[model samples]
Target: MATRWGLCGAGKISHDFSVAMKTLPPGDHQIVAVAARSLERAREFAKKHSIPKAYGSYEELASDPEIDMVYLGVLHTEHWRLGLLVLQAGKNMLCEKPFAMNSREVGDLIAASKKSNVFLMEAIWSRCFPLHREVRRLLAEDAIGDIKLVKASFGSPQLHIPRSVEKELGGGALLDIGVYTLQFVLMVFNGERPESIHATGVLLNSGVDESMVVVMKFARNRLAFCFFSIAVSLPNDATISGTKGTIRVLGPMHCPTTLEVNGKTTQYPLPEPSLPLNFTNSTGLRYEAEEVRQCLLKGLKESPRMPLSESALLTEVMDECRKQVGVVFNQDSQ
Candidate 1:
């Protein structure tokens, strides 16, 4: 069945999602409609992407019964509203990361989804990559024994837009790049919410976090140190160190372009990806799309692979961390 898709924003990341749908397995997915704040922008995106419909308002696209799913690539603060719109429209929703500004909004969205009987998920994307899946399998197989410490970080210096620091839009490293870093911790530790957390960061001029470091502790004495920043980009990576061996993710850890294992000071490559993986252009979007397809086909509302509980927990972690770090978004304090 070809899943007709409605894209709910014409942003850069949304454009990437559109591109990824183009590469999906034939008859699996297609972009049927595109919507933006304005009809002109929506028409332009529709024309560029060869979409059949363009709407000025998100409601129009969401209410379109032909759209099987809606992918939201809007502002961070807008995710919750747009997700609710799509869900209430009787369509599955794949929202951009951060899911919502806080756990409260996420909880609200989750409840609405359940009430509406619609599928809803955050668009983390990184959790579905083949290399990362192999990494998860390796840890399960005891390739790395008794995980001890893990570190992950991602950032880009180019996103200097004023909105990046604007607390109103929920713009910050934790919501942006930090989502991927936390994925590393969640993946290795089986999505266990941290028992304890302490985080600190420097806020930008508009009071959003520019850089942040969070420390988390989980089951069986496992620990993770996650870092993120927009002030300056540094390495943008993740490392898993276990008792027996270590695994170093070779790409921003978001869409690892490579992975390496360490053996007594010797380093070697893990198996290269089998199918063509999207890193730069798509950033693992295709894999997530596949995950969603499988989940929908199986009649599942929440993904066991990326459950809503973890999604809420991650935001809670960030909320607590942001509080401790004194990184306050304008809307958060309201």
Candidate 2:
């Protein structure tokens, strides 16, 4: 295996992932090609990363026989199609967050991936991070004792901004920031999907949810509550409390701002030139890409961290939460 990575969507996220891949152990990984909407953008991205090939379109990238895997950073609406294309073309794929528009879309991708004898996964980088992984370990070991309640949130003051709240683009706090919160809750619950949910939220003119508060109840009285807002903020982080102790995960908490066990808190010293959870940030993308590479080497089609089933259930949770909150987007009402 050449250990080469092909990138679809030479945008901020693909660029970030490329850079992060470079930081890996020498000879383990390399970005060989990139494809984008415009030829010039692809060329520029290739130049920036020293990639060997640049294509003017996604189909061109998907056509590369030498490419072993493709990382997709396209829009959420297009993930399903692009994923199927790559799978059919005989390449593994790691798509950006919100894996697909809904569970049905995810089912399509999953079936295609299996049919094509390849792999597929969601890039929920936060769940694969060292500390985030540690949190799960502690919970399973009962370091925190039997889990009780979970609280999490992620949002910014961007609800008023048109670009950040576009319904057509699948915008809104719930799908945008809230997905992360929901993923956090799901992880702490030991893979059990929520049995019942109660929610409330703010809707935008585009008919999308701008802010939301959700309470998810699982088996044995364990409850997880999440808050998301384009109107306000709440540490935009997470706290997992159990019988023995509590763990607090800080902002953009996927990669974690700070991870504390019990009363002692030790920050992991920020990466050089702080990386935000944006298309331009490589820190989180790097870990996710590495996980994909590792899983592939191990002959796994779905990652143990953020598998396809979880992505499917997570999508349903987000969709139903919106429904319960009486928030209907253009897509939903259609």
Candidate 3:
């Protein structure tokens, strides 16, 4: 049976997601509807994607019986509220990254998912890439022995983007792009919580972080360093060094299609999408969509690869990082 999807936002990310869904077999995935803040916008997105239904309100989408899952791709600040609505409405959800503004929101959504007995996943699309999977396999095989240090950075000059700079909108380099680097570090360390965290950053005039450098010390003297920025351009690559060898994830770390193991480069190309994507390599989203379908078919409430626990941990790490760097969101006090 095809897992029907109802998209909860009509933005560029949602558009990319819808386009990526088209890359999969129609028999396995179907976008049944889309909802946006404005009815006209929803209708336009629906028309663009050829979806069967369009809703002006997210509540309408959540209550939809035809939708097996809801993809919440709204702004960072809205995830908690919208996520709870979907889970409470008895719908599975694949929420976009920085799952919520803080760990408190993540906890509430998680509890709601358990209470509703529905599948819920944080849409950290990078973890689903073929390149990431291969990296995991190599790590498991001890290709990079001991795993001494992991370094990653993701930076883009997004000073002109309102959503990337506004504090009220939950804008900041840490929450926006740092999540990818943090998740990458955690993934390399097998989701183990770090023993200590140190973060320093440059905050915009709005009091949100413009650039951040974080160092985490994990078990057995293992260390991970991450640099994220919206004010500057960075190498945007990741390197993992071990006692024996090294593995490097090439630039555009969020959705990379290439990796270098001990200086030997290999590429994992993405599937072609019918529509042009707003983001790079978004067709790789098919992997996560397929994972959701398979998990739903098997009656699972969460994905093993991107578990709810990991989401919580990732959010907690971000929370600590923000606290250390003095980036405060409105939701933090609530």
Clash count list over all predictions: 0, 1, 0
TM-score against native, each model: 0.92, 0.93, 0.99
Candidate with best lDDT:
3
Pick the winner on TM-score between candidates 2 and 3. Answer: 3
User: What lDDT would candidate 2 get against the real structure?
Assistant: 0.80
Candidate 3 stretches greater than 4 Å from native? none
Clashing pairs in 1: none
lDDT of 3 by residue, 139-240 (tens): 999998899999999999999999999999999999899999999999998889899999999899999999999999999989999999998899889999
Q: Any residue pairs clashing in model 3, and if so which?
A: none
Off by over 4 Å in 2: 160-163, 269-281, 329-334
Candidate 1 lDDT over residue span 235-311, tens digit each = 77789999988988865578665777774322223233333433463735777888888888988897777789888
Q: If the candidates were sorted by their TM-score against the true structure, best first, what order would they fall in?
A: 3, 2, 1
Please report, as a residue range, the 10-residue window in candidate 2 with the lowest summed lDDT: 272-281
How many pairs in model 1 have backbone atoms within 3 A of each other, for residues 3 or more apart or on separate chains, i.e. clashes? 0
Model 1: residues with Cα > 4 Å off, grouped in runs: 263-283
Local lDDT at 255 for model 2: 65
* lDDT score for residue 197 of model 2: 88
